[model samples]
Target: MKYSAIITDIEGTTSRISFVTQVLFPYAARQLPAFMQQHASEPAVAEQLAACRNLMQQPDASLDAIIAQLQQWIAEDKKATPLKALQGMVWQQGYQNGAFTGHVYQDVFDALSRWQQQGIKLYVYSSGSVQAQQLLFKYSDFGDMTPLFSGYFDTRIGAKREMSSYAAILQHLQLPPKQVLFLSDVVAELDAAAPLGIGTMQLIRDGQVAGSHTIAHNFNQVEELIA
Candidate 1:
């Protein structure tokens, strides 16, 4: 394999944008109010709520107020860490309840399985929380694909558009940047990885996405590129 490790973005890369925008986002948003009310006293939820409070500079924000703020964040699609964490919590229930199975492109599933068998380590780097990433693969439309990944990363390392995050991921993976390919639909993310000497691929799944990185319409094309 040209690359020994593959770090992929979730939305718009391995997964469909609509599944996230249309299904996941709305489901999480709708559940946020009741979910918060039910779990606010729990340590995990409280910790994230505290972070959300700190972010909003409302150290003593009421639960109702906080839920409203989170709803606003959801509406704006802000990549706030607290929001992502909470969304992950909500998604866990959805997956367990069989509300939805995460959508993975057939091509992506086949390519990922083949690459894993070939000894290429697979990892995920998404703005979504690591738990959310796990949940997606754990209950995917293709069934449990979580075992295929070596690790997962979220914005906690750093913003995806920033080069330092890719540097941090390289450090964690203990791999040379050239041997790690970062795939995403977003050009800015690919650009960030590229400067750090990471192999990069842009997934133009829906329409044209302007970028200098190698472009693939689906994972089959990505497979061909690396092969």
Candidate 2:
């Protein structure tokens, strides 16, 4: 009821974790090598490849090694910046080729639309790349919902569990942290944001609310709290 900006996490919050783990992740993993090989010479791909190398601390790593490293990261769902960026690039191809559309819960789309109409600014903070975040909403299962979001933040901003990341987001939004409501299924992420004075709400889609910051079983419940 007091927030001006709403920042939400994607996986396990607005979308099902199964969708990320089962659909998106597997698709990206399967396409990574081929995508990298095809686009290795492209500027964006080349930059991300360099980033992967930097992250790996192997300045002269071969392309084959990098691909293997990326596959391993995907298996672990590591939130490393380079891995996320590369995944976004690979996902872009899938989205464009009509392989799959982004998944969003029905209630999420309704809540986002209603909130947007009420002049609340919506933003996404996900482990996924900002480009991936945009593409997800832009090509969502319910239809294009990107227009509902004002901005997207990814790991490049900072780790989700670090207080500094919430501080940075508050600064970027030019709003007091208290004026922002941060939603996620992860208690640690809510804990980090709360220390920065951001209101925290934990999505409990998996029915485990014992350790949550504030439990909301669905977007409708979240909407009521915001109201």
| Top TM-score model | 1
Clashes of each: 0, 0
Tens digit of lDDT per residue, candidate 2, span 82-135?
888888888888888899899899999999999898899999999999999998
RMSD of 2: 1.1
What's the lDDT for residue 219 in model 2?
A: 93
Identify the leading candidate in terms of lDDT. 1
Spell out the clash pairs found in candidate 2. none
Candidate 1 segments exceeding 4 Å error: none
List the lowest-lDDT window of 10 residues for candidate 1: 205-214
TM-score of 2: 0.97
Deviating ranges (above 4 Å) for candidate 2:
none
